[model samples]
Target: MPFLTSPVLPEGTLSRRPQPDIPAAAGLLLRPWRPEDAPAVHAAFQDPVLHQWHVRSSESEEEAAGWIEGWRSEWARECDAQWAVVHADTGELRGRAALREIRLRDGVAEVAYWTVARARGQGVARHATDALVRWAFQEIGFNRLELMHATANEASCRVATKTGFAVEGTRRRALLHPDGWHDMHLHARLRGD
Candidate 1:
């Protein structure tokens, strides 16, 4: 079928929360954020890496709880889906992986992720990202998925590459940070890729 003739998602298909639990590779699990995870979530956001790259952090447990609550509303609106990356054996919160900027009509979305301090260098982000990308392409029928990170975030760049995203190009001064504007590396993968 031609591009324009390709069928898009049915109406109401993305207007509610999706199945909350998804199993991932390397004994990782992706599930919706829970209220009880506030403490861990707050602690994870305290990592300086999150502050340096993400430019935002939850200062307190209450703030983290609010962040967790916001994910449910975002799911209801179909704008994003955020999952808690957890260890299967210990059930510990390892990180987060999300598909944001979901445009059902265009079959495109953006993937983003962050790892807890203790989970760094453990392939937590890469495994969770790969699993989410696969689910987005196969289950959600997204044609294209994007992963953009500050050019200085070498670790995230590696995760994107490992998850089969190709570095398409750089968007200069595309992201604002606490320090200043930073160039962003744009990576993407298609369903056929």
Candidate 2:
């Protein structure tokens, strides 16, 4: 493709800087996933609700460690950013949040998150998501961010709405879950919004 505009944020813009722990809300934070958190990651995957949506099992602490290592690598490569949602003081893992499908030239990415069974009703996902959106847009210069989930995921829809990601539309047969193809809702937020 012929060149038009430069990348909105240059390569290494994110990777070169140390990823700081972002305070999500009272008693919560978004921090880089650590190898030591592998056990918690594995445990969270055991939750049927989380596993149902993710459709992947950690299987063992070793596999969970691999996943955390990969997340670290993605941050270093500026390909994607993933964080562990945890207690600020205790460092207990509560969930996860990520900016996936990154497009540096377009200044866009998709948001993804899941919470532990014990943390589901405690606002972990919502607070973590709100903090991540602020960092992605205000601090990191993403022009827009998208949140997508199966139409049946009402909890996710609520989080999206509360975070100001307006419903753009629904995509037909967009994702394959264990139950087969699912229509997905595409929600988005612009920097100015």
Q: Any residue pairs clashing in model 1, and if so which?
A: none
TM-score (all chains, Cα) for each model: 0.94, 0.97
Question: lDDT per prediction?
Answer: 0.88, 0.91
Tell me, by lDDT, which candidate is best: 2
**What's model 2's TM-score?**
0.97
Candidate 2 regions with alpha-carbon error over 4 angstroms: none
How far is 43's C-alpha from truth in model 2 (Å)? 0.3
- Give stretches of model 1 more than 4 Å off: 1-7
Expressed as tens digits, the lDDT of each residue in 5-39 for candidate 2 is: 88887888788898778898868999998999999
Lowest-sum lDDT 10-residue window in model 2 = 50-59
User: Which candidate has the top score in TM-score?
Assistant: 2
The per-candidate count of clashes, in order, stands at 0, 0
Write model 1 residue lDDT over 6-83, tens digit each, in one string. Answer: 546544556644656788988999988889989999999888889999978888999999989998678777788899
Please report how far candidate 2 places residue 190 from its true position, in Å: 0.3
